[model samples]
Target: LLEYLEKDSFTKDEILAIKTEDAGLTEHLEAIKQAYGFGYDSISELIEELEGYLKSLNERLDYYLNIDFDGRSVVGDDPDNLDDRDYGDNNVMPKNGSIHGTHVSGIIAAVRNNGLGSNGAANNVKIMAIRNTPNGDEYDKDVALGVYYAVDNGAKIINMSFGKSFSPHSDWVRDAIAYAAKKDVLIVAAAGNDSKNTDEGQYYPNDQIGVGEEVGDTFLKVGATTYDYGSGIISGFSNYGKSSVDVFAPGSRIYATVPDGKYRFLQGTSMASPLVAGIAALVLSQYPKLSAAELKQILMNSGLPVVKKVSLGDDAVVPFSELSKSGRLVNAYNALIMASKISR
Candidate 1:
């Protein structure tokens, strides 16, 4: 669990200080404390339980880091070959307590005003789960197919919150993106988590098919920003580029849903992408006639510009204008107002 928490971006001290309000966890901890107070046999039982948990976590870590590990045999498809498309099961829910996708989905369209957990950005949007990303890295073929699947299934807006450094079959993914654009389906993608500038680096699934030009106008690339609007506005881990990233949105310490009907705080450009997607969904809900390109334009043009100088990385301070193409932070209210005016 500690390893899992660390992988989920929790620090060591943060993990140690984590206090669960869950009745089961509280009860288990209390029982363990009582066992320590009782006798050596009771303490031994607690040690055994902790050892078992640690062993399981170690095994999970081994599998995650093992390059020779091949779980693809279960899917019965060639990951290298793009032609073999018909593979994998319908179990789209997070496998083995993986809540990254769930968190992103909840940020976009979790149930609102239900008196349950946190409210999502868009209330009436239906989240279509696409299990493309695995534990280690995402396959290019899976991403392309995920886009095609969403587009063919009548999805108006697609939120892709995952990205990688390399894409072997980028053409296939670009073709799929073009297909979605042709169908007027809007795609919102995360710029990346790497602190590097995407304009100088290669991030896959971008609208730019070649050097210095974009193939479509429907695709919007988003970078992460914090709620604080000042020198520390942009997230330290968020990728940025004046030519690549389109806009910024809240991604730092964002509280959202996890697996098993729970919620947690996660931070990344992954969180930021879904936020813009949610705003796009809200605009679409209000103005259904808006095309994908128009929606993208509305989002880019209707954001709140951050004029303050912000830290790009360690000791490097630059104006927010140089960070992204729009030089603006995404504003849902402003986007809605712009959509209303455009609809008129």
Candidate 2:
């Protein structure tokens, strides 16, 4: 769809003025215009947006075709070896042009109300950015070490916006998760973007140990929700699970800071996770004594439940209640209300 839109050089008004003979092309043009808010003033904006989407698609294709691709090879560390912790440097920023970590960081803490880019979900919070995830799939060893590093360095909240279909060292990461939990550091994770049920599949760095067991109480898995609140509210590409994803947050077309201090709208469960993390940070700012487990419970119990039926994927139309463990969307206002009550 985006590819077709990119090939056309016609302005928004030009496309709208033409009476297309083909019904399908007209429908596609209208949908694209609506989705992107393309107008006479924003034609170039639309083109830039399509370019980003195209670049992402190309990277994904490269990831699949290069089966031997190892992002960690440059660091000269054995990714399979759990004991290799001495690798990597203090340079947390991406060496390449990857702005994913920057975007996630901005979602959590972007110097609120500076008349800059966008206001983050939480105010008066310092961001501790950790760059463990590479441009491609992250190593399990890197993730485990990153968790430990964050928790040990006085970070009360850790947002992990990356996940993989496989985890060869699940135990290593699980142990790190437990270690953070013991230290009262809350860990927020993305539920992935596969558009599949996570309960039927497995994405690592999750708190779940088995079919029905959870290793830690402080971990929260977040799913993506569209800006629309009614039917078809869930994002089309968001992965969901009744027993796995803990809550939903605004992930569709979320505008946040990217590399080199630029802002753009990106969508994924990754964006959703940091939004929840920022809320958790707000709750903690007011109620300093609340434990990580207490914070997680407050977030889950205080969210707004969505009763409407929504799309799970292309074919399934399930009740919104069946999409997540809490059957609720994270509401920062409601969460703060509950947090104040708990603090009292």
Candidate 3:
């Protein structure tokens, strides 16, 4: 019953004939009409007869190759292919074709109950890959377009695991994010893995543009945490900011999916972002009726808080309480438990 927007396949009046026996149909369909009202929009089918519609998406949007969210971590790109394309290496390392994306993807959506390394947050979800980013600082244009692509293609939740300190057109990226908000897309971003206070050092594409609360309530920024809840719980590479970072999750020496049908250990906020992403995917998969804004709140309100005093990095050991908004780690079991409680 799922059908992505393929406007070209049918006339406007023909499209209007599609219907559902349930109650939310009118509201859902009307949202689609407004989102895809412009030309060049598309709608892709998801489970439960749900649909995904998109507008001007990024070129890398097609890189992810799945219809359902299955908890997959990817390195983000093909190192060998990228070299052929001749993109310089000033921003990132396209190592292992998608080691970053693959690992991050694994953290969130690696096949569950399959006796794998670890279970992803969302068990029955569809992953949509939009490969607009590479091993370096992504162009604002690509990030913006990629945001649009994910939102357009029916990604109710998006994980941005990469970021740079500088940008030339952050405004465009922010605007695209705003557009996703209007469409009710949840965007989860990485708190750069710089091991510094984000308040002292800022990262671009952040939700806070010195603007008031976002146009729509569908944005989250996450930090990284290690395995232990004791000292040094915050990954040595994680960046913390009370004003920016919303929460933290497993990101150090963590194992997950990688390119070329492989898996390995990796670190960074990249890993953390996907953990939240996977959780969001699970939330949406189980309860597709939840809005993007609600999903964002679900994460923040339900994260696993620890009372341990932790160290941030090599020489800075601070009380973990002041680190981020949630001051907690992501726990799938706990999250589901919370979601159930909130449902009432």
Give the TM-score comparing model 2 with the true structure, all chains together. 0.88
- Cα lDDT tens digits for candidate 1, 68-159: 77767787988788889778878876547466788898998989989878888997888887788766456778889999999999999999
Off by over 4 Å in 2: 1-31, 34-67, 70-73
Worst 10 residues of 1 by lDDT: 36-45
Q: How much RMSD separates candidate 3 from the native structure?
A: 21.6
Candidates sorted on lDDT, descending: 2, 1, 3
**Each model's RMSD to truth, in Å?**
9.7, 3.6, 21.6
The best candidate by TM-score is 2
Model 1 TM-score is 0.80
In candidate 2, clashing pairs total: 0
Q: Provide TM-scores for the models.
A: 0.80, 0.88, 0.69
- As a whole number from 0 to 100, the lDDT of residue 113 in candidate 2 is 77
Give the Å shift of residue 246 in candidate 1.
0.5
**Worst ten in a row by lDDT for model 2:** 35-44
